[model samples]
Target: MLTKAGWILSAPASVEDVRLEWEDGSPPGDRFGEAKARARRLLPWRTGAERYPAYSSALVQLAGRSQLYDGDLYRPTAIAGEANGIRLRFTHGRYFEHLDTTEILAYEAASRDLAGRTPADGRYRRWLKDPFDLTRRSTGLGTVTLTIRTAAGSAGFYMHKRDADQLAVGAGVVHAVPAGEFTPSDIGLEAIRADFDLWRTVMREYAEEFLDLEEAYGRGGRPLDYDHDWPFGSLNEARESGGLRLYVLGVGLDVLTWKPELLLVCLIDGAVFDRIFADMVTAGKEGTIIAGPRGNGIPFEFSNISRYVDSENTRGAAKACLTLAWRHRAALGIVSDVDS
Candidate 1:
């Protein structure tokens, strides 16, 4: 189990060993039709706007927005732990469908006192226990990452405090930087089919969150070429050359929102990290970047992790990413990667 994060359904696993695949199709209907109906009635939802007042008002005030298209998303269909590692699958899903489901559920739970207590009288938590539940508790995937910067004799990671006004779940909470929904690069069929890889979503978020670049998926009615894209190309090359490393700590749902999260972390060579994020924006669409350790992140150390992980302000997935990364630092080459 991911101790601090309380991953509902997981054991010890690693990203280097997990195999992932996706197909275009519909997943079974979620079991939350009744729950959604109840939550809406219990909360003060804006009638026609289809959002809670706080979430709706925040979006109206934001100066810049990250995404124009709600678009399609890859819904988790299955996850099987194999002898070698883990196997995960996804299917096609609509954006608004999720907003109307788990998004609203998160707001409902938060509005009540059910934030951390799962299975509270066999309610929302029961539905989320089985991540691959056919009744699909969640329709969207959270590709949240702990962005690590490996420097000479030192290493640390970045943090993002989500805008409570805009985000329904884990609002104003600290999270790993480059966090985003697992979705396709474009709204087209082909893009939906092609952008299922986990790294693609991570890279797109990095380009937007760190560099403040426009969303890197196919823009201008053109297909995105990962090999030629500025940040994606650089990130891929660095990984190939052993200058950057990607690892998956595990997958689970955030207790507050019960939203599925493919918890992950990326370690980058200091030189490469510096170069890529040299012009990093202090603020982006999601919220302000917590500049720390006198730089872009908090120090990835025991004290910092302990304080944050145990705090009520940190998101479950973010804490899980940090806790697992620290526990597996050796296998991840986190410390040695820089000195080497």
Candidate 2:
């Protein structure tokens, strides 16, 4: 039976029970907060790119209505009213339990090389358990495509171009925003055994990438008018339009980082979304909006999926994400066939 502890994957004798253990091996340090702060400072450029001093090691996957469809096609699972968090426990033998310092460094190096980026400098401490290292069972990072739907129910997806400082996976290719790993800050260390906190990652990313937390807070204003603390509460009250709908699209393996990743779709009221986008794209607010190929500003800056799908520059897991988003546009509630 599925319980708070974990769901049963098989009969008792043969399968291991869902388990949660501290990655005691993560290089000791209190740099998690500092790393997060630095990444926050970078915004869309390298948000969460710095190798933090340490982080909680946890596995993430779909559950309780969210499921992977045929490996490629994304069947988005939508949940509303309140945030839905999926808690998954691994009973498999492949999830690594421990790693020596030397092994951790080697994994980090390989991860950088594979992603076509430089090794982590001393900016922040390195996460002992590298999710990019596919050799080991890395933490499951979640990437979300926040969709803005018009009053007419037509949906628009926001994709950004990766800058030089970011990983090479899709450097120039346009891809979704508000994506990152599920760190301990997202899922509390104490509660790791009870839940994976998937939705929390979405909310946090939404605020950071899409809403610009620093500016929002600077104005004594909160995105979505959300008056809450970290690991946010129910975002339903903050919804501006028809309401917020979250869909667990599918999973894609990052060929560059060698980590398993989850792609999610978030639908919000178009009017509210446009207002936020407008605020960021005004004449003096260029940097506030992330631009890419084709154009370098707001609505004009957003690229169509078709234009980049076949481009040689768009490759790797990001390419997979673009293809999936486009393939499932109709299922994702996108109404405009012309734009899709």
Candidate 3:
């Protein structure tokens, strides 16, 4: 059964051994910066990027600092899988996302290495519960377990699915053999794991970029425009700080993309617009968006930004639509309507 299960050889004796082999030897600070840059580069494709600038700006204005980390308060990389069906593997030292009652039982069962060599009947039953429920209820979600067997012994990992996919998708059983044993069949799982870690580091860095932009804007007293290279920086900050204020005039679909459109009629009306614009100019900052009865009027509705997507497929598609709106904000009168 073990051989039929397609399990491979065990890994090195200790996690430290794996780390020694995989550590990039770079300073943590520099490594973090590089990771953020990569994440920023990928932002154009993700909705998080578009919202990040505004969210971070708001955080700065209200909280005085942008959120740098999720502060999940649990070990990172414990749960592994796509949206659902995520399995947590804990024995290998990864501990994140608190576990719930069901998962706790499973952990106990797996720990016992029971008579059947899997999990006991009751524990196995809990394991079968919906992974989402287990995750949602639990404070910490565990890791996914993979067992590999070889001539020497058995090894496993509580690793992310992406890392597992990278390995399993390849042609052969890739073992991370120590410096001594070398074979084509032997691939280093540590290398793959390191790659996954690097990817996450980059994502956090990208988040920080927007956070910094928000800080700079808030410090400038919520400017409409700044000397920054990105023209959208000031406006993005203002929207986030609630200084600009967004009013939904109306929502409709773009005939081409089938994506939603949010109409902006104007920033400020007569007296309010003049007052705020003059104040901003005097403060050496550009003006902000102020829409209302004088500009667009009350009950002016725009597409619900938060309800943009309902499912994963639509999530990606909706983002593509939003990207179009962001790029064409000026040409389509969105910018003029708001900024004017």
| Each prediction's whole-model lDDT (CA) | 0.67, 0.37, 0.24
The clash numbers for all candidates, in the given order, read 1, 2, 26
Clashing pairs in 2: 52-125, 53-125
What TM-score goes with each of the models? Answer: 0.80, 0.49, 0.17
- Off-target runs (Cα >4 Å) in candidate 1 are 1-16, 28-69, 114-138, 216-220, 294-296, 336-340
Clashing pairs in 1: 30-135
Tens-place lDDT digits, model 1, residues 1-340: 2222333224334455667676655555645555455444544445675644332232333323243344677777666656645576776675655665566555455445455544233354454455346355446778888888887767878888788666544668888887988888887778877777888888889888887787644443777889977877988898889788777767775655556777788888889887777888878766788767667467767887788789888888888887878777777666633221
lDDT of 3 by residue, 183-226 (tens): 01112343224323311221122122212222221112322222
Report the number of the highest-TM-score candidate.
Answer: 1
The C-alpha local distance difference test score for the whole of candidate 1 amounts to 0.67
Q: Best-fitting candidate, measured by lDDT?
A: 1
Show the lowest summed lDDT stretch of 10 residues, model 3.
177-186
Candidate closer to the true structure by lDDT (higher is better), 1 or 2: 1
Off by over 4 Å in 3: 1-97, 100-106, 112-114, 124-128, 134-136, 139-202, 205-340
